[model samples]
Target: MRTPPQRGRRQGRTTSRELILGSARKLFAEHGYAATSLREIARDAGVDPAMVHHWFGGKEELFNACVELPADPAQVLGHVGELPAELRGEALLRALLTLWDSPAQPALLALLRNVTGSKAQAALIRQVLFKRMLALAMAGLPGSAAELERRGVLVASQMIGLMVARYLLRAEPLASAGHDELAALIAPVLQHYLTGPLPGTGSAVPGTGHG
Candidate 1:
């Protein structure tokens, strides 16, 4: 009669990775992306900091794994690339549409739907927008960090609305709009939010006679 294998001793890397992931998820929900640290997650998991880095490279990668995000936010948004200021909005919009249409979209939509029912999940989504997506989109543009963040918030509102209306609610015409048509129609507005003048920035409104 052979003794049963010891499960704890046998499961080394797999168990440790799961522990890191579980710890990351709970800490991220409580403290958000910026506040959560890889070291803290590792400590919570009873793993060495080196183990967390070995498995997930960094905090961003760890967060991605916890959420089961199918694509890296950096890669998806980095599609904006380097382009003339005027051309970036359409490029960014196209990238977003492409992501939405990809096979990974189901995973993303699952996350989105979760936001409606869970405050923790909603905070997760918000943290991603502010810390990852918006920061990537707004980087290198002119303004103080606060102003840029404000612009990013406005951009987020429009993009979020488009995502919800077109994908979640299946609202008629928008849901049915061809990708190119939607991009062409909405890109300018996003562009304006991103790089154009805003009320508080001291740029005169085109028709309002106020700065």
Candidate 2:
């Protein structure tokens, strides 16, 4: 059998793992995710680049560790399936808004800032939203796979736009809008994405294809 990996520092008080993470967090903040490289982080931490892979699987995992969210994305999307189909859209909006309004807001804001600052960060957000969040939300919804994908994209677009306006740029009326009011206004479009008819497609009955 191959030899097991070594543990602990040879001399310094700080572990190589801690140093790597500290360097990664600092570099990611300063240069953004896409701009920072694994080698660069290793150099700054005074460790070999291989140590980064040993400590953290990859840059994405390291980023996730550094930017731990207060809430789980899958758990946050859980309410979407529980609500009545007609109400699911509103419920999703309200949930998202509540999350932004919570103490977790700072972390969420930092995530958004990082996404805006780096293409790699944006890709990670897309993966989480599409693979995890939207996939969960789309479960039991009516549509062909293609149709479901299209609807999911529309919903993501709407949500991202709302986040940019309300949270990031702090656009006027939306920024000042109450949670309930915003939900009332935004829910219909989301509902449309979930179950309503597209321009070229036949009408879809609400609550069909539910498991």
Candidate 3:
């Protein structure tokens, strides 16, 4: 068997596990997820390929780590399950913004930025955010599947736009806004999406109804 090449002195201080993760993150970001390989990651990390398997069970597990998802969204959302319907939107967004503003957000930003770099990343985001997280949230709600799906899409759209404006484009006002203020500004729109009537329903969305 061929011995793995040793890293130069500057790279020597880096541990094999850290090296693998860093290399994987970069490769996954630069190349699409599907194109990146454990062998390549091991080579970049200056470790034997076996080390990658020893640390991470497989490529998919490594990908999950790279993406930096916190708890599963369903699990995260479930904690607020007891919140009243009228307050759920604000409450949900408040919790989200709080999480996004925490230390975890930087990792999330890196994960998202990497994902945005390629088609494979986009597909992966769709699966994680839309299909897994949001879909589960919708299923837990008492509503038609169409309604749940539509509302989930709208919430995602708003959140994506906010992320783009706040982080990527760095729109001045929003970028500078406090998280609480931002949540206040965004929660109503989110509320509308979550409980609002379907466009063809001939009525204001549920939460918006004058009653």
Candidate 4:
């Protein structure tokens, strides 16, 4: 059998894992998820392909690591997409709110905090919002592709703002706000962003008139 190519200078376990992740984030961003390969990632990290599997089971898990999301987004948010379009906004929010209440909060907060100042991170964020979650939510819903994309981005913007305000920055009453209260306040705007028409001038969309 052909021996695997020699890897980079022997490195510590932590260094090896970090190298794999760094290589993964860049390649995933540049080439996208489907096009990137385990062999490619391993090669870039200067590790044996076996090391990639040892660190992260497979491509999905590897990508999850690159994103620092603790749960599979499909499992967490996928069901929300199955609901009626009108109900999706709230469902999505409630699902996320539920996850935030779990032990994953720290990792999620770190993800939100680190999204700034990194183009690769920004691209991964876009994939979650526009490519994955949005595709699932908007499936079978009516709208032009551009309009749907705009709505999806708006929805993502609100959710991100909520995460930062409530969890990361811990700003004011928002930080103290009850989950139900936040749901009541934010869900409608999310629904609107999903289906309501955008105004020609202001950012105001409906369900946002009060808070």
Question: How well is each residue in 44-160 modelled by candidate 1, as lDDT tens digits?
Answer: 999889888888888878898877778887788875745666676787788888999899888879978877867777777778777788777666778898888988888788888
TM-score of each: 0.84, 0.68, 0.63, 0.79
> How big is the RMSD of model 3?
6.8
Task: Rank all candidate structures by their TM-score, best first, as comma-separated numbers.
Answer: 1, 4, 2, 3
What is the TM-score (0 to 1) of candidate 2?
Answer: 0.68
Tell me which residue pairs clash in candidate 4. none
Candidate 2 per-residue lDDT over residues 1-211, each given as its tens digit: 2222465435343477778888877777666667889999999998888878876779877776765655776678886876667777887888788888989998898888877776655665665676557876777877788888988899989998999999989998999999878987888889888778786577554554657
lDDT of 2: 0.78
lDDT per residue, candidate 4, 101-182, as tens digits?
Answer: 8999988877776688588898886766577767776677777787777888888889989988888888988888888898
Residues 94-175 of candidate 3 have per-residue lDDT tens digits of 6666767777777778766867676656666665676666654454666777777878898889988888788778898998
lDDT for predicted candidate 4 compared with the true structure: 0.82
Q: What local distance difference test score does each model get?
A: 0.81, 0.78, 0.72, 0.82
In candidate 3, what residue range of length 10 has the lowest lDDT sum?
1-10
Which is the better candidate, 1 or 2, if ranked by lDDT? 1
- Candidate 3 residue 77 C-alpha distance from true site, Å: 2.9
* Model 2 stretches astray by more than 4 angstroms: 1-67, 203-211
The TM-score of predicted model 3 comes to 0.63
Which residue runs of candidate 1 sit more than 4 Å off their true CA positions? Answer: 1-15, 207-211
Model with the higher TM-score, candidate 1 or 3: 1
